[model samples]
Target: MKRRTFLGSVAAAGVGAAVAPGLLAPAVAQAATYKKRVTGADLDTNSRWQVAGTDLGIPYVLENGSIGYLFGDTFNSPWPEQQNNDWRSPVMLRSAVHPGEAGGIVFDSAAKVAGNGRAPEIMHNGHNGIGIDNLWEVTVIPNDGISFPETGRQLVSYMSIEHWNPGPRYSLWKSRYAGLAYTDNGNDFVRTNLKWFNDADNADPFQMWTMQRDGDWVYVFSVRSGRQDGPMMLRRVPWEQLFDPAAYQGWGWNGSNWGWGRPCSPILNGRFGEPSVRRLGDGTWVMAYLNCATGNIVTRRANTPDSAWNNEKIQVTFAQEPSLYGGFIHPWSGAGANELHLMVSKWTHGPAGNSTAYHVSQYVGSV
Candidate 1:
């Protein structure tokens, strides 16, 4: 899990980072043209998901056919004061709502929180000196989670942040490391030993990731810790070797050819934040993210996950909607069709007193 260890694994896999790229060209191409639209209003509000205000509404299919979402920095009450009452990060919510009825997604939800009706902070935030290493963690932000049909279990990736600096360097959230946590009951989770450390630069590529399982392998598309800028990279591990960091392989250009098992390389380049990728029911792969360059939620499609990612991007939001990030693909939206439904978040920060627009909206997009 350490950087050297990961590099060693890459070397042990028979691919060196110093290898020349003369065999093939990179997998980037001109963007394809696509379009989108807002299908409904915000999908989550203060009254729903025990989440008065939260972000990162990434959802994945559960074994029981329900949808499970991972939310970040939550405030269950009013703003400012909302931080005082039952605020927790990385909360999980379960919903039985069908993808077709995503506009009403909040109606069929319940958090892990019991009688209090608040969603439980499924992972430790390291506030009480209790974390994977017993150190007080600055924060815990959920990246993305996936449920494996082979094991009927789920694995979630998260960042154990160190601190967040104020403006001028707003986006640099110094992360302790990025680790994996697994759950069997969907409610309780246990952290695994697997982690990718953030060294001097605090820029680890696996910090933010979205995963999808195809055949025996789970493809991981990732970026660095800071959301401002970084190229998205790709890696894969056998479903059975999910926890074995050494078993993972990267897809990259060997200079003359685009192939698998090369040193990890960029498939898509941009000022990307949290991203979501999933294969549509029609067999197309779609990647959605907050484009910091344009300040909009955009998406791109490809025939295969490893194909040249240069497809026309579809803008998923409008100019009127600002201060928005997070474009999580709705699991049920691709069940039997390519109807794209996304869970988008909006958060505008100012001086402490203003009412910040912090909630998740459901949007419908197309290729």
Candidate 2:
């Protein structure tokens, strides 16, 4: 496929812009609409989004005129005490977002049992007890289909079983399972015991990311983020049986037909960051994630949901930040031929000279 440089950065050596069907038309139109690259300004420059040392921001719009973001490794206190203490807590930040507001988010609740198992949270190792063995990261979405119960809350699903105790660094040790949860007022999210997905080993531990619901199925876009931060894995279950493990099936993309398979095959290539995916008005799927190699936000597009994706463009790079990690697309609303909104974050420990901190910041761009 023929291609040209996007501005000056996205060349063939960088982004893989294809000239296939449904790919070239968008590029020519985008060049005419946007200046060079699609970049968004910070919503508020006065104050950054404050929370415990956290990342993997999953943002969604609520029914009560507010925005909610579910995050992972979200601490209750400061560093060392943050991830080392209650490292597996999944927390939320809710706010009435405005353009020029100083501070962000109105209410930030304490960490609760967002993704713990049915058993007691305290795990007795014969002598001492531990409770940080449940969910560490999550991806929540609203039930957009008809005939669904109006819980005044959005339907939530998350990944867990991150064993952090009796270990060296407390890295996310093997994802356990994915389950369901829900909340309305933005805080007080309740997780259910029904685990709908899991893998026996770390070969392909699915880290649940962005979710989309069509007619009767809820399509989940996840990554094998543990053993190998590989391509995006797709899974779907009937809308009525989202919490039932037996109701789900990992899509087997075998070049020809997409069928059921365990430990779902990778759809894209290269070790990746935690990703967020959504369908555009033109039936193309757009996925945005932090490219670990470039320390920049990268994206890819696919003609079909379970097919080979093309045109991986490096969207934006945070040059001043350290540990500039992955990006998660704001799942509710943020996309166009020449513009999109995203929540990207970088990690921070203690001090910095003159750089961004450990807060999830928003960016809008035309990628």
How far does residue 366 in candidate 1 sit from its true spot (Å)? 1.0
TM-score of each: 0.81, 0.63
Candidate 2 lDDT, tens digit per residue, 243-267? 5778778876565655765546555
Shift in Å, residue 186, candidate 2:
5.2
Query: With candidate 1 superimposed using the best TM-score fit, by how many Å does residue 319's alpha carbon deviate from the native?
Result: 2.4
Of candidate 1, the 10-residue stretch with the lowest lDDT total is 1-10
Q: Write out the backbone clash pairs for model 2.
A: 38-365, 38-366, 40-364, 290-327
Measured by lDDT, the strongest candidate is 1
Model 1, TM vs. native:
0.81
| Cand. 2 TM to true fold | 0.63
Error of 2 at 136 (Å): 12
Query: Distance from true position, residue 205, model 2, in Å?
Result: 3.8
